[model samples]
Target: MAEKLFGTDGIRGTVNKGAIRPDMFLRFGEALGYTLRKAGDRPVVVIGRDTRASGLILQSAIVSGLLNAGADVALVDVLPTPALGWLTVQNGAAAGLMITASHNPFHDNGVKVFGPAGYKLSGAQQDEIEAIIQDPGFDCTVPAERFGRVVDAEFDVSSYADFAVRTAGPDVSLSGLKVVIDAANGAGVSAAEPVFRSLGAEVIMLADVPDGVNINTKCGALHPEGLSEVVRANSANVGIAFDGDADRILVVDENGEVADGDQIMGAIAIDAKAQGRLAGDTVVATIMSNLGLEGALSREGIKLERTKVGDRYVVERLREGGFSIGGEQSGHVVLADHVTTGDAIIAAIAVLSIMVREGKKASEVLSVFEPVPQLLENVRYQSDDPLSAETVKARIESVSENLGDSGRVVVRKSGTEPLIRVMVEAYEREYAERAVNEIIAEILKADGQ
Candidate 1:
């Protein structure tokens, strides 16, 4: 393992190479085992993975490292990422590891590590683990007598399902509603339908079958176009899609209208405020959230707190401010009263619960704002820092000035992907689109693309 192996999420990259190789995965687990030992004598590590061709090899390799390092292991094979964290907290394990690439294609994979408290490892903690993994003299195995053991974790789908059920509250019901759940052929395949069915909805499933290579292939939250057609065809009351690890969600309405995370947050925030469950009258979102969401929350007297573009950062701000709700535009909604991370299934339940409680369709209940016209485009570059170029800065400044108070321009590098994201929001679509295109052109010119 090299320095800064962990990305915005965790140690993710193309499998069999770079940070996600078998050897590196083992080292990550070994380092984690040592870290866990600092907390308890008999440290236990719980492992879960989504459906992918590389998941099996990676899981076994990680288990080997954990056992070699004198840590007991429980394997919840093919479970969602949040479920692993929940299991870690439920079993009181020292640490939790989830193998998934989330919305990435099957060729890539990752390992997300959580602490005993079920929250992600802090930045300092991640740095420490990386240091341990990189040290040439660090041992991967302990003495034979101190070696740990591994076992198959009892797959209790109900525990997580129960959490989702409870998130909707006792009075909420989906008795007569028709729902469609698109699993993206990943970890949510086993859990999504069960959770919805237990709530009394007639559920329709899409992309629920996982063939390893097909996970997240034109399905799930990242690409819900297909789900929209199904929802419209079936005339279902709502459609819900999840990423590979099931931590993020995207919603589709009966008329095939899709709502991004910002819309979801806006709707949920309004509902929480009406019910007086929105603690401190605040909502947390990442910097990538739509500007309209902030306006909508403001109209309801709910404050919108924006952190850097990550759900972990959003959750951190929520915890620091004693807030109860936070999320990202990518659909990573974290309800503090529910699970630690963004449990997409629970988020779906919460949104649907609002629909039932209001006796309205999803489009009606989730229509919390008239979003500002926005355009976001990514430009790939082979430079150390593409956005620092004089020409790029000039273009960004020019666009910001042109939009004036009615628009905004945000240009930044993606933490996980290799591109600079140019986001322009304006009162009109033409302005936003033009500004974004101009920025992309400037970036490409700078990169000599």
Candidate 2:
């Protein structure tokens, strides 16, 4: 039997390899179609992709599978994952498929599914789809008359821009501010340009041209140094860098300092509390979030809840706890009251709104809390079986104890790689680095490296 392919987020790997191969994608689509058909009749699936060269091939294979399974497909050419999610529900589709690997390198790609409500499929739902994919007797055929039809919809840059503007409200506008945006040459390129321009800000764009291979080429959130340099060179008020799919955003202040998701959440949380708009006066973040962020929110009498690393988990916690805001430290902010998922465009608007309303620089507005030093290292193992090794567990426990209250340590196997992530955060950079290094050394020793 083929190995199970789905990861914590979705099936992701180097294009044409492992779970990301064309055949696998075709099978995945067929399985998805079968699952949706079992749930109801004549299900519709909306599809979108990033500007990757391999995206077209994967999309074609997926569409073929969906069509072969007797479903209708709506092709929304080159859109962000969140937009595809919103469009899925808006068009009453049974499922939405976004073709992009998010922050992964250019050679990699991924597929993430959304339910009819524009939310990601639950763990059980993914498992069911996987089961169907692995079933030998599952029907992969479709009737000629019932084959899916694909309709090309004009990309609605205005609709998303309008939604972002409305979310910011008419009272808030960045009339005289100058802002620089690095779209990572991915899904947000076209939409972010118009949205910022419409909001009355002088917009400067970098990495906005997507030639398929250039998406996230050392330019987006994963590499904000370029954006920071641009911000400093142009003396812009602020800078926003978005990942490949534009679901997450990293902000660069006027001083060209990077303000990560935790800082942004702190700023927004404090402001929301002051305005009495923070539901339950609480915010949700991942365990990877900085300790300073928790302290900052706590000082305001707002509760902070930590979940696992994925934004899906963060969103789940937010929904279950009735919280209005939550996100990952990587800038995947979810304003659940406004959008169903992490939206870089919406988060950018929120950050810009704070600047416009306060008449402050992005640096001034975003620096709501001082972040502690954090170090993260990913150690690849020779064999995947070693993650559950006894020595690794003992090392993790020992490191956790050493961290105590002065610092934090997290060591876990990567859901998508044959590696373990070693993360340490503390008030002092040296201590965090040493803690992470020691843990990595232990993992290396166990691996006989």
Candidate 3:
């Protein structure tokens, strides 16, 4: 069997390791270039990267491969993932690639491919590229005369910032809002501060200094505890934290309470429904979304559709249903009306707009629903197929039967990492904790951990 390269997001792993190495990235770029060349002659492929030191090396190698395979390259230098996607569509490129591991540590890196419309690649497209990369006999060389040229397109980042500010509409302004933005020391540092300040916001930057290795060390959406504290210390109206690539966000309220994607989506859905802007009166989220979100939307006469655990799946379902809003609990909110992928800055703008419109504190508007007690535990595994173990399966089944309809258990392997995510939600915190602990014990035992 062939090795799988694409994950729920994209091709990601530790930098200089496995398929993330420069040599493999060069071939990966060749595969992508070949695929694009088949669609158009000397197709343009827009490329950008986050603030990791490895980004430059990987970018050089990939650009060499793309040029070698007869694809013109528009290098955007350092830009957020969403900005790169937006630029790809604006530049009429055949495809786009953003090099960053998102919320992962700086030593990690990735390549997220976007189609012409700035959406993620479909399964069929991924397969085509993977086949070319895995085939040892595949030829990637092209005639020197047919080689493509490279162009400096770094100035286009401002265009993306303008588009992001426009997502909140012309009437929206952040004049009185004091925003604490945690840029994860990544690509967002370049755009987030400028966009917010342009709208008259008093922007306080946090974790904004990127020293290559400090991208997500103790900051960003994944580690927003510090963001919450800073918000309180500064008495800011709201705090927003972006991951390494600035694709997703987690907000902190005025009182320093962290708001995850579910809360953010709920607030957006409620506001959209009130404004009659919510298409189909629906919000699409992942199965990992809390039942509280469903109940809250239900009360508002809105339908909540659940997909698998990826933001891509959420976007797919939203498009299928023509829903205007969707995202994951992990801070990947895709506002289809504004973006094709999870654009953290745009989503933050939406939330801020809501606060401005309602004339309320971030604490008042962000907590749209009271989340039910939920516990998610990630268990690492070195063995293969721990879910297949009899003890683990039995424990899962037994827990399900015992919890019945009042609670639920969701256990699945992480697509991007070697671990199992076990989530349990119930009406009571103790019950949820106990159920999660039991499942973890069984999983660890099964994996011989």
Best by TM-score: 3
**Scored by Cα lDDT, where does model 3 land?**
0.91
Pairs with steric clashes in candidate 3? none
**Better candidate number, 2 or 3, judged by lDDT:** 3
CA lDDT of each prediction against the hidden true structure: 0.86, 0.86, 0.91
TM-scores for every predicted model: 0.97, 0.97, 0.98
Residue runs of model 2 more than 4 Å from their true location after superposition? 152-157
RMSD of each: 1.6, 1.5, 1.2
**Tens digits of lDDT, candidate 2, 280-338:** 99999988998889888899999999999889898888888889999999899999988
* Candidate 3, position 403, lDDT: 89
Clash count, predicted structure 3: 0
Q: What value of lDDT does candidate 2 attain over all alpha carbons?
A: 0.86
Score candidate 1 by TM-score against the native: 0.97
- For model 1, residues 1-449, the per-residue Cα lDDT tens digits are 24468877888788876566898878877888888777777788888899999999998888888888889998777777888888888887888889998899999988898988899988999989899888959875678898888855554556766776777778887899999999999999878888888899999999999999999999999899999999999989999999999999999999999998989888888998998999999999977888889988998999998888878898788888989999998899898887889988988988988888888999998788888888888887887776778999999999898888997888988777678888988999987888888899989888878
